[model samples]
Target: MKNAIEISHLTKSYGKNRGVIDVTLNIKEGDIFGFLGPNGAGKSTTIRSILGFLKFDSGNIKVLGMDSVKDHVNILKNVGYMPSEAWFYNSMKVAEAIKYAADVRGLDCGEEAEKLCKRLKLDTNKRIKELSLGNRKKVSIVCAMQHKPKLFIFDEPTSGLDPLIQKKFFELINEYVSDGATCLLSTHVLSEVNKYCKNAAIMREGRLALLDSPDIDDDTFLKFYYDEEDL
Candidate 1:
């Protein structure tokens, strides 16, 4: 089977500043891969490169067997992405924003969207600008998962969610993976990775520092980050 994601000697730079350097990794199909790192470690940069959100200086990226840069449109067709920060049209209602997205994707997501809203305790009638940060995150989650895309990419997806809702979110992700989908989770929270991920990668200074099963304890993982800087 082909890998879900592959990167080789990937490098991205901003003039004198480095974004990521020679980063290489593989995420197999049907696997939930955890991307772990301290702040400013380049995790988000790497993700943006994979999503073709920015142009890289060198190297190659493939998602679901398609070139990330050359075939991004089709690649995104099978992907659901949740950014670290959730932003929506401030003037629209939660339901309206979600429905618009689902319609664009050509997915009949009304039933599933409603179920997810209930699970996350989101008020669909609320205006996007009126919702709290946590509620906005909930709306983003529903929009991302409602279409049941084959690949899920979440960047700190649980940031403002309460514990109860976080648990439900993980349950939903597990259910998605059980059906043979793939996931790439980038988070600062180690326990979330330990609870759901099968394999993990640690990034530092825009480079891959470690890649292994996340069986190690949280303290051990923290030890890998000697610097206290936030990425």
Candidate 2:
């Protein structure tokens, strides 16, 4: 099968500190891949790089079969992204924000967006500033998934969600995966990875520490973090 996401020796530096260094991994088509790491471990850095938000100092990244740097706009058309932080124009209503996102993507997402809002119980009439953190996240989720893109990229997507809502979010993800969509879920939660991911990669200090199947037990999971790679 063709790879959905491929990275090789990806390095990005911020002066004295490294953003990501020599990180290499491949996410196969139709796979739910977990990008696991602790805070400041370059998980977001790698993600941002893949999304073409930040230019890396070296190495290469490919989305689907295209070079990420050169084909970012095209890549984005087929990808749904939920950033680590959700932000919107404070003055816009929830519905307005959703519409604006759809307009920018040049896709009509009215029906799916409305369905998602109802399922997540989001108040579309409320102004962005009036919503709680979790509610805002709900809006972001709808905007990201409305178009039914081929690939999904979620960064700490369930941060402020309540348990029930988190379950709903996972259900939506499962539905997407069931339809053969690929996903890259970046989070610190091990249970989330173990439950959803077919394969997983652990990042430490801007480098890849391990890449393996997610079917391992708790003891094996802990051991990967301690294992060192030559890269």
Candidate 3:
């Protein structure tokens, strides 16, 4: 199968600190690829490189069969990205932010965005800075999904969301995949991976420690990591 994302010998560093080290991975088209790592394990760095938001010290990255750096603008047009941090103009209303994002993506925000806000129980009229963390997350999701891009890149997408909203997000993701859209999800939630991802890559200490199908049990997988450390 053709890959939606490909990284070959990718490396990045911050001064002397390693951000990523000789990393390589492939996420096939139409697959929901889970990226699991503890905080500061270079998952975000790698994602940024894939999106051409960050430049690597070495190696190559391809997204959707195009050079990551050279084709970023074109690729971004077909990709929906939800960053780890949700940012908005402090004075802008939630509805206004959603509308701006949808417009930038060349999408109509009239019906779909409104329906998503209603389903998430989000108050569209509230200013961004006035909303709670969970509500901010809802606004982000509503905006991200409004355009229905071909590939969705979610960085810690469910953070600050309530359980009910998280469940709804999962349903939305599955619905997208069922319609043949691809997804690359970066998260630490192993349970979510077990329930949703078909395959995953686990990053440890700036490198990929494991990459395989998600059918394996967490206990067994955890044991594998422990054994690797001679524990």
lDDT of 1 by residue, 71-165 (tens): 99999889999999999999999999999989998878999999999988899998999998899999999998998888999999999999998
Worst 10 residues of 2 by lDDT: 222-231
Which ten-residue region of model 3 has the weakest summed lDDT? 220-229
What candidate 2 gets wrong by more than 4 Å, as runs, is 216-231
Query: Candidate 3: which stretches are off by over 4 Å?
Result: 220-231
Which residue pairs in model 2 clash with each other? none
Q: For every model shown, what is its TM-score relative to the native structure?
A: 0.95, 0.93, 0.92
TM-score of 1: 0.95
The candidate with the higher lDDT, 1 or 2, is 1
Across 1-231, the per-residue lDDT of candidate 2 in tens digits comes to 889999999999988887988999888888889988767889999999999989889999999898998899999998999987899999999999999999999989999999999999999999999988899999999988999988999999999999999999999999998898899999877899989888898887788866657766776666545536632
lDDT of 3 by residue, 1-231 (tens): 788888999999999999999999988888898888778889999999888888789999988888888898888887888888888789999989999887887778679888888888999989999988788888888877887777889999998999999999989888887887889999978888888998898887688865657766777656534535566
Of candidate 1, the 10-residue stretch with the lowest lDDT total is: 222-231
Error of 3 at 143 (Å): 1.9
